[model samples]
Target: MAPHPPQSRPSTGPDPSAIDTSRRPFVLIWEVTQACDLACDHCRADAHPARHPDELTTSEGKHLLDQAREFGPGQLVVLSGGDPLTRPDLVELIEYGTSRGLRMTLTPSGTSSLTPETVHRLSDAGVTRLAVSLDGATPDTHDTFRGESGSFEQTVRAARAARDAGLPVQINTTVCAQTVDELPALRDLVDELGAVLWSVFFLVPIGRGRVLEPITPDRAETVMQWLSEVSDDAPFGVKTTEAPFYRRVAIQHRRDANETPTDDDIGRRLGITAGDGFAFVSHTGELYPSGFLPESAGTVRDGGLVERYRESELFQSLRDRDALRGKCGACEFRHVCGGSRSRAYAHTGDPLASDPLCAYVPDGYSGPLPEGRVSGD
Candidate 1:
């Protein structure tokens, strides 16, 4: 028998990007553990079976929470890792962070640890949101990417459990050459799971991810075009991670359609790039511009996070679009879409290099490649 086609619907909530967060970093990604049971092909943490002995202690975690309050009160602190659920003290950490007036989110690798009881417990512990990774639509595709059999089934079960427990779920999908073709099917799956948000993370090669081939610049642009169309009719808010250029693409699309673009839309696009309104603290407390951009600014143990982020050379470089090398520095959309530093760094060793995955030739770009422009992998 033929199955019924999935129905298209509009998102009930406001655009996820429109949610007002202060210009300062209003969110922090804390990798609380580096241990995982699965060896996914594109794992940024290069996770292993055993937990790191030097991973942040419970006392240190509480202290980091204290520092986070000073950095941005009521900030959204995301508890992530190879799999945050691998840590026995995850709930305790969540409770502590919540008690400190921080909104908390959890990202657990879909594995045996994400049981039904675990979902309810996380909801009870004041986790406002739960994000699970779903790279592919089908079991064979997804499980193969995750490097574990039945991972797709387990992730589905976990997502359903989280939704049924009244916890909002966001499905994070990694978009790469290998997975791009499956986005339509993944979208249908997202709708079926009733996910509130579908976050498409463009590949940033680092750690184990270095081996995976990222989609070409032209392909990324095409995917963004498709995403711009999808977001308009999808029942859930759609967002792109590490692909800030989507904002520029959206603005151009709106302009081409003769629709008026709002200031909020522009502000939202310009406000949230890698080091500007985002920061990451590794499992060992080293701070970086973002989880994907692994150049360390300083350790949380060295000084206050706010000070380090504001004062670090890398952060400063990332914030100043004029400092970018190659066509990115000259792009008209440079401010709104400075391109992905992590991607730039992944392809070239310099984090300040232009994002190789951006195909858009800036207005006034000359014939030959600009001086100091680094070639991509």
Candidate 2:
């Protein structure tokens, strides 16, 4: 008479549209090679000269492209590497991505001068844009960070070459404690180079960067303030993603002043966030949910790209609240910020832990937040 009824469980089967939904991935990053010429201090890609089978061949790359195309039209593909330019087959790979309705882009170290012939090939291959990494304002600082002499010269040359080739060029700099004091010079450099946009990302402590503390709270604020001031007079538009609150306010201020300038307009118009507009594929063909996250969802060689991502628990978890831990649940800015999963894992040694970087934000800033608590688990 006291026997209890059986408990029931809810269905958790996969949704058919989960892979092909347009609302999900707006862009994808394919790391064709981890073989790089220069060794940067803060690089998380671990891109040193090493013998690894992660580099994709022409057929393999095309197979990945075919899988990516299943996400539907207008998805952007970023061809990255330890240095993507080092690959001789880069042009053909870019062509393959573009031919599949993926707008192709690349991120290069700028260690070697991009040959005019190569630039022409890239143009013919339909490479839409190129982003060159520039971590410091002056030659001494910039070249030093890259761990090579004369890198600044080569980078500047490459930037000019990309621009002259009719490919839009964007400069990406990491705002660390070392470079925090040089915001003005950085802006000037952007202007001098005729860059389309200046993207400043916070230095995430991961990989080789784990040993160093990037910046303190006070220093981060100082850098933010300086960037705000410099961007006011900048001819080229400035945009930042990692530093969300400060950059959001800065962009709004400029927009309110009737400034029509914008960065990643295609992404903006499409309502794509930094992570959504891009997915980083490792050299071994394992597709990550985003560039920085360590969780490998699946490999491109597994099968059709769309089917693999669809079956990925890690990929799905990225967009789902159940996958988050601790403060991310209640974070006020969870939607806009999405928080940095990779950053959380690296700093605290917990993938689901709250981002330690939040400690840098000032106390009085008004904004939405995700879960404001953290866990050691």
Candidate 3:
């Protein structure tokens, strides 16, 4: 593990982190395929049983990886999918990205395809991490959520295999009304599985995810507070997806605890929401600010990936927090904890609108509050 070369950040105004979104993104997720073995209840992809006929060819995928490398050395290239294993050339793609000096990560669905051999092959191919979803502590709850029996057992086995293969594992959990109560249990499992990180994803209503119930703002605040506590004691790091307000809650908690925050405070508090420091390329080359956000800024078929991210009007608007509406625009923490752009789009049609999942209301606000905003004066 040689230390990664420092990213050549041009300027640091999102200063505490020194990650300049204008030049390159911190993460670029490419949905390699929309094909999957299970129909999970909260799947943002609404995946199908087979890959699309118009999916990017292997050469096209390599080209996309090359474009992603322009972000600079150590750029994270996540090969996400409905199930990347469904593709025959997954290892080939992984090896290509590794050769480009990009830190490649894979998020394959839990299934028979995630065999020990496959895990080892991916590790040998230079995958930086293996992210697997485990929504429940018990088999019944997890299998049901995945809409497939035996998925729970399979997922656990794959995680252990990843660990055995000497690859770092990241446990991903879906947090919503259905699974919120299981957070404490999930944390134990994350530790048992030797995961280095627990990525808690709060559900945004979309695709197959629309049917799942979102947690109310007040409840969300409580969960984040608990998570902040969990982060302090848990051996593995905890981070929220689609819930940037967790950073606000964590920061507040630190102050209340009389703890001095680190310069990399916003590192795990990554909220570089859609089109800001995050970008997603769908299986068909459609470019989105996030996998949870369906709005297309441009297609890879039309122009360069980096060009679209830096120049598109949609990306430009999303990156501009001053142009935000409601509490998000007025909040002093807008630069670092600008709220979840994907959640905002899920609530209101406008991506620039306020994220409804956050309980915080800036003082002296006089605009229409988000639907289901915490009840208070």
Highest lDDT: give the candidate number: 3
Cα RMSD, each candidate: 7.0, 13.1, 4.7
Full ranking by lDDT: 3, 1, 2
* lDDT tens readout by residue for model 2, 1-377: 54222122111212322433334465677888888878888777878776366577778878888877777665667787788887877777777777677777788776754655555567667777778878877789999888988888878887888788766888988877777667678778888888988888787776667655577644565566666766667777676645544533444444552344333121232223333444677888777765667676666775646654555665555555445565554544444444556677666665555555554332343343323422321
lDDT of 3: 0.84
Against the correct fold, how does model 3 do in TM-score? 0.92
Local accuracy by lDDT, each model: 0.81, 0.64, 0.84
lDDT of 1 by residue, 194-257 (tens): 9999999999988888788888777888899898888878888888888888887878866752
> Each prediction's TM-score against the native?
0.89, 0.79, 0.92
Error of 3 at 223 (Å): 0.3
Worst 10 residues of 2 by lDDT: 5-14
Name the regions of candidate 3 deviating beyond 4 angstroms: 1-16, 256-270, 371-377
User: How many pairs of residues in model 3 come into backbone collision?
Assistant: 0
